[model samples]
Target: MQMEPIAIYLFVSALFILVILKIKTTNSSSKLPPGLWKLPIIGNLHQLAAGGPLIHKVLRDIAKKHGPLVHLQLGHVSTILVSSPEIAKQVMKTHDIVFASRSQPLSAKIISYDSANIGFAPYGDYWRQMRKICVLDLLSTKRVQSFRSLREEEFSGLATLLASHAGSPVNLTQMLHATMLGFTSRAAFGKKYQNQEKFISILCELLKVGTGFNIADFYPSIKWLQDITGLRTKLEKLHLEVDSLLDEIIDDHIADDNNNTSMHEDLVDVLLRVQNDRNYEITRNNIKAVILDMFAAGTDTSATTIDWTMAEMLKNPSALKKAQEEVRRVFSEKGYVDESNFDELKYLRAVIKETLRLHPPAPLLLPRLSRERCVIDGYEIPQKTQVLVNAWTIGRDSRYWEDAECFIAERFLDSSIDFNGNNFEYIPFGAGRRMCPGMSFGLANVELPLALFLYHFDWKLPNGMKHEDLDMSEVYFGVTVRRELNMHVIPIVSKPV
Candidate 1:
């Protein structure tokens, strides 16, 4: 009476097919917002063609047609794209408590340790505690300032690297990316992986998979396709890469535990000490998750910002000249810029602000999922719905800014408004409780290096390329959005001191 394995497999497959069919048949009604015609199960799959540029732009167009709060079915799931600032405020402010949770994919969950980290964790006590620890212990103003020497050391190296190839057009994007990777990796883990390129490549792959439009994310029934097509394999490779690096780092800490007596600290040291003491319900896995969050969220966002900032500056020479003038005038004859000089670099701050407005690293911010039914700007948003606020469109909204599309740093020179997520008009880092806990650390990472770059090097487009013709087209991979092309700038050493 023993059953054959083939028969059992067939029976399970049949059951799964029936379950999928039943679910598709049951939820076939058009309860969501108005969208293009859809087929059964696939919904808008054909419409969401490759690259997603048309979809990204069309979503805004649809919102304008349907309303500020527009809903579309990706597969079995419901997606709501919010464009108007009014609706964004409702979701992020009025219904903050209900919609603060993250709707991450399974791969994201595994890499992020079941959403235990702040960037991907669900809205609850665990997130609150982890975010608190990150802010107070690791990302505080004092902690960020303490890392000034690291920043200065890295900046000097970057300047020297650029100076070595002064006559040639250097790819600032790639160079800046390496600088940021080194800075964040060392500050977090006390050392950069020897294979910096491999480590970063894995990170890039993870971000790609996490943010890359997958047919399965919108449609639950087709999720098995992700496994069948080796998407899962890629994620596995990335996870193994990240995990191995972290494990090696942890081993190093244990080996050096008895004799290491450095007063100057890094994040790994703090987390290791906390883990050894068995304090605060945090285990080794949780520590790994937080460190992963720090690297993933911290490194890419900062690097993307620097890249975008430089791109924007290159496109607008007037702004670039103004910023350079301010930097050079302030730090004339100084070997290089440092944290102490940041306070006086007013125009540099404005330039970075303008860069953020036009190109927010996290254009949609992180997607927030609702735990309960809520109303955003009089539109009813049901429970378990995904909420997306287009900070990209919001930043370009003409109502809050004059010539919003232009890259003008002077707009902020006399204004008190900032991008700390407080002002609904400009929420680059987001606001409220879920605001990026690492804001200070991120800002310091951006400002000091930016000032030094402008002060030391006069930039120009490569091979007589006109600034007006430079490509501003973007390709969004994940939460981090980047320009479609790597920006190259010729650094003319301006009258050496």
Candidate 2:
């Protein structure tokens, strides 16, 4: 007897469901860590939906009940949320070799050429090579020093833009966004991007799509939603626009032909030269991937932190006043700030560090995938299980800090606790080999410009707006968390000391 089409479809669906359920049951029973209830198709979906800003709060609570290593089934995948610091250290340090692989996301694959870039690439020789390129050639201290002129130029532009809108309410978040993007473009391509504003707008939109929850990510069969809804088309168009911009920059270099081969080269030129040499598996797609990672992760996160730092300072007037006074005192007579002056600006560095403690760009570091079974906190984490460390919550853990929630730049003023991922207690850039390679470069991009802004101008809210009225609500746009309301302040030229 032949079955009807609809009946056959239902039968197949039911069979798949049974198979999945059976697998989940087996996994659940297999001496794995405990977790919240598993709903047949959605498993732990309700928990994620309910857990908001303090997703870690929920995870911590769950871990308390289930033990330190709690396994969660979000959609079709199994994820392990590690809340304890010991477990986090082990995953990031002890077994770094085995757990260094990044979970390959569909969006990251296309943009990063199947994780060829350092930020999301799996642990291997490819990642090692990318790190070498980023460090020795691109993001090294010497390389960053070479880009000082570019930074100074961008800071000048920032000052000019802020001055034009002085004495009136200005959206500083917007200014910082533009400034950080300008810095990245100059460093990466050796020239300021022509369409700076539009470029960032498009890239942010792409980041939203990349990090936003998608049905396709969990249920690939419904991938048609992304395409049918034109979301895919939108991303493709933006990708092409970015491609055109980079291509034009590449063309200019080619046209110049003799564009000073001896001088310090920008990231694009280096990557292109590497591709031409065919020394390794590097390709055009690989270059684009690295560039995209720099923009998506490096630019946005640095800018977001600067914006948050400013907002926090404005909220706490004393901190703002103190930071500005330090800057003015350090460079009272200097016409403009430079990287050399950065060493003397200690308080400004503190402000940036304190801001990161409260709002890490990625509250939860990118999920790590285990290559083999392991035991964490006396609980079993099976192979391929996704692991996420709550850096946001970790930063605020009172067990490790005094007045954890308070933004006191003084805490870092005399301390050696840096964000280069060494001190797990303050890991804005993450820890171990997977740590962010652009930390030094990214930090410099934030500091000098921010110090200059404060030194030159006195910031305040709009007329008739009280400090209490300044909105401090936060919003997460992919990896970077920003103020829900753009920070608007009036920048008044300070009386020269």
Candidate 3:
């Protein structure tokens, strides 16, 4: 019954030819970039539906025809898709502040404690305070370095398990994902909590709905439909459930009188200490939101990156042989691979970099919203417009790369290109003020397990499947690119030299 007015409005809007004409005339003079013809109210939403809901592939195809910078109207959301490195520089570097604030989606609002977390928080004082704490206390070099021993212990445990299953087909994806969770759980919430699996399952469910593109996000005017569509109700339940769980964890920490005197502090301890301090005004919700960000994002993305890296290497045999050889030769000589000497494994680093280039964990690298109307390269961008820099497309663009589609780790060996935000050509972790602060921690999650996986055993495709036959296809539903099929492989023990 409540949707009747919206239904009538939609019916009436479809026949408002005069309104469409007026918009066309205004847009003609305003110099909007080229995009597909839009329909009344729907505004290319139907077109995107017809083409397929995979916005990454849809936008990439549109950019191929309309040029690197293309305009789109996803419902009423004014969107600009940037597919080239040059335009990426303009958005990420030149006019970063103009596009710094995120357009908070409805799902984000429900799940992130109303965008209280750093990743989705609108650019402002609260975001600044939270980010500073994360950088200085949680994600600082000293903090990340402090977690080195913890990572080594987790990696060793995983490697031992894999070795026992040598000469058998194992679900590398499942194993790696579980181990990464344990690793992240320890770093963020002290030891692997008794409810790590429950927390992980709940978090994953929340992310699936939160990160997905909801109808409400496209047509926010009908935001009440978020409940109509059932997304909000589902998220609200999960939010309460997750909140209860986090509260228990924080309560346990509060009960620990010795936490203050302990030499090592987990992220939760640090946040609690700050909360108790008079210098910063924070609540328990803020602490939980921050830790949620640490868990969901810090674990999932690195695991996705590792999975894609393994898939890509499997598809390209020479790269796999080279990566495994480099890991084994470098680490075997030292009798073990640890953080202090891990830096010496240059090729492994390059493989990780190359993997980031081809398959960035967040392909669109987080959507940024235009704070005010601005012009970029003569195209007028209206305030509140969504700006998505296609990091995946940019990474594979031939203009900046030679043999761009092929997996070649050597390109990054002795090369200047890096994942840091400065170099526009490659921004797997993104750039500017909103660039991911957890890069160090995320990299540690990916790099250590990846090196161990290579060093501990030789991996092969199941059932005599040739490397060329392995599927490198991806799952690009929203922003992240995960493997479409599970990467099942048999692990063989590596012979000692």
Best by lDDT: 3
| Model 3: number of backbone collisions | 0
Q: What digit string (tens of lDDT, one per residue) describes model 3 on residues 1-497?
A: 99999999988887687789889999764697778888888788887777775566777888898898888888878898898888888888899999999988987788888888889999888988998988888899888888889999998898888788787888888888788888888887787678778988998888887777688888888768787888888999988888888988898888875745333888889999988888788888888888888877887788888988888888878888888888888877676767776787788899899999888888887889999888888898888989988888888889888999888899989898876788888988889989999999899888888887777777888899998898877776345778888789987777421
For candidate 2, the clash count comes to: 0
Candidate 3: clashing pairs of residues: none
Candidate 2 runs further than 4 Å off = 1-30, 53-68, 192-201, 220-233, 261-264, 276-279, 333-335, 495-497
Each prediction's RMSD to truth: 7.9, 6.1, 6.5
Residue-level lDDT of model 1, residues 1-497, one tens digit each, is 35688899999999999999988865643345455667788666666663266345666666667776777666787778887777778778877898888887766666776767788888888888777777777687777877889988987898889888887998888888888888887887666656656766777677677666666566555668778767777777788787787787777777877643334678888777655665466877788888878877887789889888988888888888889888988887675576776778998899889898888888787788889987665456789888778787788878888998888888899998887666777888887778888888888889977887888888878889998999998887576778889888898887452
Q: Global lDDT for candidate 3?
A: 0.83
Q: Per lDDT, what order, best first?
A: 3, 1, 2
Number of the top TM-score candidate: 3
Question: For model 3, how big is the CA root-mean-square deviation?
Answer: 6.5
User: What are the models' TM-scores?
Assistant: 0.88, 0.88, 0.92
**Stretches > 4 Å off in candidate 1:** 1-37, 192-198, 221-223, 258-263, 276-279, 333-335, 495-497
Model 3 error, position 28 (Å): 6.4
| lDDT measured at residue 142 in model 1 versus the true structure, 0 to 100 | 78
